[model samples]
Target: MSKVTQHEATGLDDLDPATAPARDAVHFRRIVAARQQVSDAEDGLREAVQAAREAGDSWTIIGAAMDTTRQAAHERFGRAR
Candidate 1:
């Protein structure tokens, strides 16, 4: 997936007052959709991590799969269950 820069996400560049309200509405919808997607993804990740732990996977292994430190992963998702 391509990365969206801050400028692209904010929709603030070259905004004119005449059409700003319409443009801002579109931007607000995009932000809301993005936030929902992120929330869904986090829920899935938590479920996957819980499954992996139940299947005898260690925090180190799970963290490696997530490309993060073991402590970080545990701290974030340990109480998820």
Candidate 2:
């Protein structure tokens, strides 16, 4: 039995330039899907932050969790409401 690597599992390593149009379409679709996923995750994070604040979590704690300063966290997320 042959071993299948991670690249083969994702089909990205199999893209051929000879099929440039089809390959480009597939890549574009993947990019769109990835962007949607990121947007969804950001929305979830915003909601979680709101809930955390309601539960008495501080900017200092949220900033630490995000690897940023308290002021930075506040600047990025505080105005969402």
Model number with the top TM-score: 2
Q: Given candidate 1, what's the lDDT at residue 42?
A: 93
TM-score of 2: 0.69
lDDT of 1 by residue, 30-74 (tens): 998999999999989999999999999999999999999999999
> For model 2, what is the error of residue 27's alpha carbon versus the real structure, in angstroms, after optimal superposition?
0.1
Q: What residue runs in model 2 are displaced by over 4 Å at the alpha carbon?
A: 1-24
lDDT of 2 at 65: 86
Number of the predicted model whose lDDT against the real structure is largest:
1
Provide TM-scores for the models: 0.68, 0.69
List per-prediction Cα lDDT, in the order shown: 0.89, 0.88
How accurate locally is residue 76 in candidate 1, as Cα lDDT from 0 to 100?
A: 92
lDDT of 1 at 38: 100
Ten-residue region with minimum lDDT total, candidate 1: 19-28
Lowest lDDT block of 10, candidate 2:
17-26
